[model samples]
Target: MNKTDRLLAIVLELQRKEVVRAEDLATRFETSVRTIYRDIQALSEAGVPIIGAPGTGYSLMEGYFLPPISFTVQEAVSLLMGTDFIEQRFDDDYRVRAQAARGKIEVILPESVRNETSRVRKAIRLLISDKQVTPSKEKEYLEKIRRAILDERKISFHYVKKLADFDGNRHSVRTVSPYGLVLVQGSWMLVARCELRQDIRHFRLSRMTEFIALEERFERPAHFNLREYTPSDDRHLRVRLRFNQDIADKVKESNNHYIEDMEEHQDGLHVVLRVRQLDELLRWVLGWGADVIVLEPESFRNRIREEAQKMLKRY
Candidate 1:
């Protein structure tokens, strides 16, 4: 193991047991007694609660504690990588808070540990694009929503819904009991209890304008399950498509829903998917452009052809 790993292991070992002999640690870490002594001194200088006596080895000071800094190596790497990714993708105050939290972790880390962390952080990256115009009001609303969610308090928010086919016709001014927030398909959604519908609903956060936390508190339902709220009605008829080699590779990389089978074709590729709804599936299939061809379900093919004809006539 490297120096940082050895040091982390030493601290964890000492925390688990009341005392660990220097000779035992040296043997476990495959180092000499002198090296172990130096490591202990390093830990002490780093403000670790390490106490020792001559020949009695070392022990963590009783009741002297460090703030909980527990994380698996993979978990730590993921957090560091995710924070860096968000820092570039989001241009909001939340992104600044995330970066600050990452900085705090690095500041408290031992020099050796910090160096290892930096190496990992430098290796991961995310693609950047045009800057998104994040609304300042929405950012403030998110801050309040986050605090209410953490504290398990009721929050009242005015939600607005824009009509799809009608211009200047929209629905606004509704209140909800906020449950949780999630990011799905590159969009932020607030899952909550709709007062009018009396059912759980997911509201896109960007669409919500005004929000307020209520003075009343509500207990989270004991049977509330977040995973159960996602859209998973998969009983609709199936559809098949054939895509070119390049498009097939992209689909494989995404690893998303409704991929039943794939087979190589002389010209391109063949793929099948079982979809529950034709409208949503049509949108997704058309998104692939000419790279994909409809192969089955004549009803869906007819719908696509009709839509294409309508668009051509409009043009």
Candidate 2:
């Protein structure tokens, strides 16, 4: 079902049932609990009169009901189009659920409105990503961490660091009190108080394995705010790339965030980027294969070559 239809159905479902657990809603709708979480949030924002009990479920306020309501064709089209962002930004499971929600919206609309929505959908083309990053292998781990955060619980996990120091150690176990999840670039990082280090640290979810929630719960800091904890800033590495016409557009496509400047040159498109890590830049350059060349910062090119040789040796 489409998001709009699911939203409407959710209202009806709540009216019929006194209280419903998020897990039950996820099962009934064939969606992730997170998706149901967001849906409940959206419903509350729209003044659906939803009240929640910590462990039990969500229920409608005693004296509330949805008034008879319907949307115009234009309204439905606008709402459906907004789901594109949800599908683009979320994981595969959420995307599939969003698509199903769209189908539901279509099913409920009158024939004339449905036909219009379909026409609008077909005529308006949208492109999110040229390549979808493989769905994270750490999906289950992410859920565990999220549950811990919500429950004010401590979590223990085995983490593999991406960069090994001179000690040549890559693995360690950590016990942390999770703060919140943040999306850094395309990576999901957990901001937490590291019991091992005795400080707050950011751990990439992708690098985490063997996650477990401990029975011990930690008191959340009174002033802690996830948005304040994980912030985007302008300070970054300055680097440039020379892209051939064959993949100049692809280079532009990859980074809309830190792109400092783009110039059309006789050779191709020249891209200037302000970035955080050279490692990430090197990987992006490799993705373009022969079509892109590093223009300066000899250090980055050297690292890329060293990594390429390492790849060759491993193969």
Candidate 3:
């Protein structure tokens, strides 16, 4: 084992009992007694309480304890909840790493702390929206995408897009130079350069049926900024809407980037948003049901009206 691992093992061994002789440690580690002495001295220098006597050998000082690497009940609950949330939402090595991290934290914690963590977690559970359904293959696709992005390699993937009125359709395989994966609204998205489109496009991970990493790699542009890329012509689109007071109060709870202004009115509230896409704005407005109304931009208002009419006909 490496020096750090050996040192940690020694500490854990000492915690179980007191006074471990240098000879025993050396024998266990297959190292010389001199090396064991050196390791102990190093630990002591690093503020470990290694007390030694001429004959009694080495021991951690009585009542000398390592700083509690403990988390508060709330902190533990948050960590567990966040880890579980990510596991459902994203696919990457980070998900497995998070599980391992949680295991390690729980293993190292004292019994009382573990019990408290468990109690808090059981008492307060995460509540995700029912509409948020993560695909089973999402993690696998994400892993391949992340590998390609990190290695600056091109990737080929078969994508399926669902249409509003038609059956889901699949496209013939295409290659792209993947730039990055974005997590937006609890869904994973990949932003990449589509060879066919000759431009960057966002692909929802759930719709990516298959992904294959290519041997070919490319250098990302030095000036490429993912944050600067937006679907709208102006990168930012201002919108105005009217909502009932009840819905207005609910909107106030959200901190989405698009929301810019909110004012109370006799009937409800007027909301102004600086958004990136009309589709996104429409989705938010529709989510509030009939409690919201589009006030400006005849084009968007007409679009919403048409979509509502379509939904009405369906019903």
Best by lDDT: 2
Clashes of 2: 7
- Model 1 earns a TM-score of 0.61
Identify the superior model by lDDT, candidate 2 or candidate 3: 2
Q: Where does model 2 exceed 4 Å of error?
A: 1-68, 74-137, 165-168, 182-188, 197-200, 227-236, 256-260, 275-277, 286-290, 301-315
lDDT for model 2, please. Answer: 0.81
The TM-score of predicted model 3 comes to 0.59
TM-score of 2: 0.57
Superposed on all Cα atoms, model 1 deviates from the true structure by an RMSD in Å of 9.3
Residue pairs clashing in model 3 are: 91-139
What residue pairs are clashing in model 2?
Answer: 1-100, 1-101, 1-102, 1-104, 2-101, 2-102, 2-104
Q: Write the per-residue lDDT of candidate 2 for residues 53-84, one digit (tens) a residue.
A: 98999999998978866778888888788677
Model 1, C-alpha of 293: deviation from truth (Å): 2.5
TM-score of each: 0.61, 0.57, 0.59
Which residue pairs in candidate 1 collide? 236-276
Q: Write the per-residue lDDT of candidate 1 for residues 32-81, one digit (tens) a residue.
A: 99999999989999899898988777889888655677665566777777
Shift in Å, residue 55, candidate 2:
35
